[model samples]
Every structure is written in C-alpha cells, then in structure tokens.
Target: MIKLQHIYKIYEDEHAKHDALNDINLEILEGECVLLRGHSGSGKSTLLSLIAGILKPTKGLLEVDGVSLSKVPDDAATLFRREHIGNIFQKYNLIEDLTVLDNIITPLIPTDLSYSDVLKLADEALEIANISHKKYNLAKKLSGGEQQRCAIARAIVNKPKIILADEPSANLDLNLTMEFIEEMKKLKSHNKTIIIASHDDLLFQSKIFTKIIVLDKGKISDIN
Candidate 1:
C-alpha cells in the first residue's frame, strides 16, 4: 500500500541544509502491519510523515495506494489524505473545549455527510474503540487513555485505508499501552494497513507486527 524508492528528504534554509531521510527504499503491502523502530534522528517519523503527505521528499519517488504522492498537487493531496489516511498522534490532538463526540466528528465536517450520518459514523467509531460512554463529555474531562481512545475514534471515523500512528504509546503507562495494543489488533482485523513509528518497547515486542524496520543515521539499517 506504500512505496518509497531512493527517498531523500532535505530541509534547506538560509543557514543550513539538513537531511532528514536518505536513500530509503521500502514497500508495504495491503493489510500489512509494520513497526518502525528507531531512536531520535533515525528518520522513522520522517518516513511516516512522507507516507502521510505531511512532508515531501527532496528527491525520490513515493506512492501510496497507487498514487504518485511525489507528483500530486497540494490541494489534491490534502483531500486524498483525508479520504484515505487516518493519523493517530502522540498527544491525541483533541480540541480541549469540544465534547468527545464533536471532536470525533471534526474530520467529517469537510465531507458531505449529513448531521445524522456524521453522528452515526462517530457512534460506530466510539463503539469500536470502546469509548461510547464518554461521548457526551468534554475532551479535557477525559483521562489520558480516554483521550487516546477519542483520538482513535476520530481517526477511523473516516474508514481510512491506511493508519499512521506516531509514537502512540509514548504517553501511556503499561496498562494503557496494552489498551493500544488491543486497539491495534482490532484495526488489523478490519484489514487496514497500519504503520507505526515508535520507541515504545511494548509495540516493538508485539507479535501482531508483520515486520519490524529499523532505521539509523537517516537510513534503513535492517528489517526483521
């Protein structure tokens, strides 16, 4: 579902030119769950960003779900990403003032779905994530694990084909980290392509991960 060939991302400014990813080649298939394991400055996050259209490579070819991401126009790519990719952030990225249900449906606001349809979608997502009980509560009132569940609901509400989770367990304790592992299992059951960039050993140790790709010095070092 994702392909990157000779991908190099170089950030250029007036003062310096820094390479974030270099000479990377990867191919991920449909319904495959891949874990990206690396320390800081290893380009794991950069690779995820490139796949999610959050960053563009300086010189390389990238394709996701068959589109030439490197050549797609910005406006088109944004819409395409919204339609095909679901992003789960480390901080949850919820609006503090919004209710859980409202935050879950925020991504649907851009679509042509009706109010009731949006509510239904959010309801289904909440149910899938086992967070329906907190649907009416404000985001700020929820616990860390609850907030993470809310983020998961918001992400899959669109039924995205690809799920990009960046350091999802970074903030959670062992218990909550285990909750995320269960959630990953559920997402995989739905046949969604999952890519995770993480430092958490819990995820790195999970048996559900089809492959573990290691990165170092801005390049892929090994795939286990």
Candidate 2:
C-alpha cells in the first residue's frame, strides 16, 4: 500500500520557483491497479517518482508499504525502492549491447545473490514477461515490442511488490498496447500494486484498472 498526505514537489531556480505537484494526497491499497490520467505537465510522472522514492517530497508525508519514504535517508530510500519498487520508464532503458538475460540480471548483481540465483530470478522474470525465447538475443537486435518486454522483465526481476510504469504505451501501436495491458494483468494477478502514469486512452478504457485518478495543473481534478 502507498499513502501521500499534503505532498508538494517544488523546483526552484534563482529567478523562479515552480510547483510540480501541489497538495496532492492519495492512498492506493495493496494489489490495486491504478491509473494516473493527465496531459503533459500535469505532474503525473513527478507523482510516480515521489512514490518510487526517486524524489523526496518538498513537504508532507509519503509512506509505501509501512515505511515513511519522505523521512528516510537517501541511501535507505534507494535500498527500500530496490527491494519494493519495480519502475518501468517510458524510454525502455536497456543496455543495448547486453543480451536480454544479462540485461535482466543486471539489477540483481548489486545484491548478495550468487550468480546462479541471479540467473534463476532472471529466468523466472523472462517467463513472466514472455520473453524467454529472446533471452540470448542482444537488446539492440530486438524489435520495439521485444525490447519493451525485456524492460518489463528487468523491472520485475526483483519480484517487487509495487510496479510503477510511466507512459509505457507511448511508443506502441494498438496491438502492442494490448500486449502491455495483458502483461500488466499478469502482474496484477500476482498481487502486485500497479500504478501507471499515462494519458493513453487505451489504458483508460481497459477493465483492469481499479481506479482512475485525474490530475490537472499539479492537483487532483477528479477520481473515478
């Protein structure tokens, strides 16, 4: 579960200060599939970053699972995020030269797991992402959809309890978008808390989303 209370994220320069998020408060329960719907500059991505512990709130409280992320030290937050959050970026950040399996195993390298255990986890993640056949292929050689699947596998290789996806369908065609929906459904079935920040209508129309929260001008405009 995740909770935010009176959260604010502000960016300041010498000349001006801008609030990326303002007085945003939300609570997402465990195993819920949630959508953050808004146009560009609505602070959706900023909200996701805050929840993932990549950005500390300028003010207010943020708690994921049971820990207060807003108050934690940066190193502690990083470790907590590594253990609990699976982040899927819009750009599908993969090492171009690495094989799919190797890319998936990269995150586990920093942990205490042995090489064999890392491979085991990567294998399981590949199976879940439906990309096992491409495990040996170079990341740059894969098609867009294949790369996306590889990214998904890498994100979830840690078996994170929460999955945060930012504009995951921005590059996909309709068919690939559908594939993403199906993949997210698989993650949901495993009781993963899924929060996606996207304006894509395809996701808005999907039946898998448990709640849709609309944002405008860095504030919650509506909730459905």
Best by TM-score: 2
State the lDDT of candidate 2 residue by residue for 1-224, as single tens digits.
79999999998899999999999989999999999998799999899999999999999999999999999999999999889999898889999999999999887887999888898899999999999999999999999899999999999999999999999999999999999999999999999999999989999999899999999989999987
Q: Itemize residue pairs with steric clashes in candidate 1.
A: none
Candidate 2: global Cα-lDDT?
0.94
Runs off by more than 4 Å, candidate 1: none
lDDT of 1 at 19: 88
- The true-structure Cα RMSD of candidate 2 reads 0.8
Model 1 Cα displacement at 13 (Å)? 0.9
lDDT of 1 by residue, 59-106 (tens): 999999998888888887898889999999999999999999999999
Candidate with best lDDT: 2
